[model samples]
Target: MVEVADDRYATGSGASPPLHAPRPEVEVVTAAKRTRRQREAATVITADARCTPVLVRAAIVGKARMPRAALEILAPNGAVIGNVALPNTSADFDLHQRFWLVGDPTPGSVVAIVAEGGRQIILPGSRLRSGPAEGQDWSGVACRMLGWERRVAPTDAPAGFQAVFSSDHPTIDGPGFTKAVRRFRTAAVTIPLVFFGFCFPFLFVIPRLVQSGTSTLSLLVLPVLGGGLMTMWSAHCRREVAAQAELVEGGAARWGKEIAFTQSYWASMRKPSAAWDGPMPAAAV
Candidate 1:
């Protein structure tokens, strides 16, 4: 069997072993093919669109401690797909509806593999099971090979939508007045420039008027005028900042509402009797 250095090569006993000492030419060709397959990938909506699908490029199969583990892809399938490795842990796959496999995958298809734990692995078409019986569930066998039970409901569909709870909501600061305060704080930095602009021009003009025989009246009056200008500018900045803060609050509320709606929508579309536990037929070449 062709072997990868270190942990990648399989070492345990199995019902069927990989091809021993594959021909050099065949190995080279397979490696090239695997490289090419990793680049082709697509994200699919599965489980009645309850679960978001992620594609990947490659995978690694090995044991973590005494339990089996897998590292696979969840991105663009290509000549060399990237994969994430997950260790086996105590998690019930059956509860998560992890029994389905993409049936009859073409030469380049995305495959999702659930590990013993809650962790999942996605791999490209190059690493899939080859020469399987028609209409057989490869996901079950893959789970068993990883030392896990084939626990899946035949017709239990996932709930339709996901919820956006306040606890998990994304926020910059607090709600209500605090949000306004944050915006005002940001504006404070820029408002000073406006005040300075008026002050500088008045300082130059007032001194010229004093020297031009105005008995320095312009100098005295300019300070009061500049002060008034500064006050007005500060008010303007505060108002603008507060307006921006209102936008932030409104936006957050809108996002939260959308997420809640998505959850409810998915929940309503669930089909409790739809069975995905059946065998996934062998992929086509």
Candidate 2:
């Protein structure tokens, strides 16, 4: 049972407790093997999806508290790999999950006690269970392990352990937005350039011609055409942005910004049903 210094951690709540010992169900693996981070990630937030209530004892180390009380999980590279949007009504969470682990005691560091397909994993969720879209029914409570105040339990002990996480979804089973992102990448750059290209003629060329007192009527067509094209290009860029948003909406991609949620009313968390725990027998949990 390793221990982390209390000062090394911070969260929405003040000064969390010292780390808890690791769970017996955790999976320990080496970094050399391929990871299961992408596979076990939430594809979509649905009631039918396997829900779990494993305790999460890690300290919240995000840059700031999310608008909806969400705890954004960061990867080793700091790119978002996953997020647990608290059961806030306005938040756009694609999936809700929870986890905890004990391994490294270094404050702010992640311990990979749980593993999936050889990859270390952690559930960064609170049992304030919730989802997007109205009429969304949840298991009633979204639960997450908070604080290091070790609570002695008879059969099941509750302790907050440190298991770090990440967000920013990756492409599933394919070229991971290679084509879509590429197309938009081109449009983002080209559209702006195209608009300015036309502006050059309209601002300079047309103005000079008009000043010369030449029959500006015929040349007026250039500005008109340019203006039309610019309008179309602007529209195209906006549409692309919408399309991108749609693609990542559900669990396809991960977000790095604060997501709004109907202020998650803080509450006590109950035990969650197991969604996924590496190599654990059903009877054990």
Candidate 3:
């Protein structure tokens, strides 16, 4: 009887079979494609509009760190309606930052996030996530990110209208006023210190030198020179204070305008038939 040799058991001159079948060679190309799609989806910006003010969330990823990135909300006509600065991110990681768009975006509008290195991401407004903002603690996040100068609060109006106003009022005890006062006090204190610092050496040295038989007239020149320098420094300090005061005044004016605009905006939103007709008034300015 012709019997075939048991080649399956033979290992001396032939390669042995794998203990288990290879995991049907993982399709690297297909897997890569799937990973790419998932990453693209994850990085997309999503919007939430159930609340009064619209909010947008972006998941930024990659090796680049964009410290100066800004989110720009565009109208359907391509005009920039709102811009929010994003927080800093480290290299080779993902960061999620959200901002409330100043005004509602119409359908077909787009959102773009521009990074410092010219990297920009554009997302269509159609990718909005439908949900209510009632349970979400978005205020806390806004306060942390936008600071007191630009914070939003819920209003007593119906339909859950919200108001965006600055906490830096122009009153005497307000943040803006207090900051200006502090800067003035700093300048007041520094002016005297600088004057004394410049005169200290001459005041003490000249007296001793005069007593030691140095020419009294020559020593007098030193104090006069020190006085001249102190005068120049004082004038410079005064100019600096004036410039700072101008800045404070300008900021106060801006603060007032913002408060007024917000009040008007809120009033308009409260109307039954009123809709966001255009971008924020402040944004236009």
Deviation in Å, model 3, residue 163 alpha carbon: 16
lDDT of each: 0.32, 0.32, 0.32
- Per-residue CA lDDT of model 2 for 16-83, tens digit only, reads 65589453343222111222431222222222333232332222232213222344334334443333
List runs of model 3 lying over 4 Å from the truth.
Answer: 1-208, 250-285
The total of clashing pairs for model 3 equals 0
What would the per-residue lDDT of candidate 3 be over residues 1-285, giving only the tens digit for each residue?
A: 001123463457667777873322111111111223223322432332211223333222111111122333433344444433332221211122222332234323322232211121222223222232121122222212222223335566554333213334232334543444344434444555776787777676777787889997787675677668656654454444334333333333322322222222222222121111111122211
In what order do the candidates fall by TM-score, top score first? 2, 3, 1
Tens-place lDDT per residue, model 1, 203-273, is: 76766776778877546765677667656754554554344333433332222322222222222222222
Give the C-alpha miss distance for residue 185 in model 2, angstroms.
Answer: 3.5
TM-score list, all predictions: 0.21, 0.26, 0.22
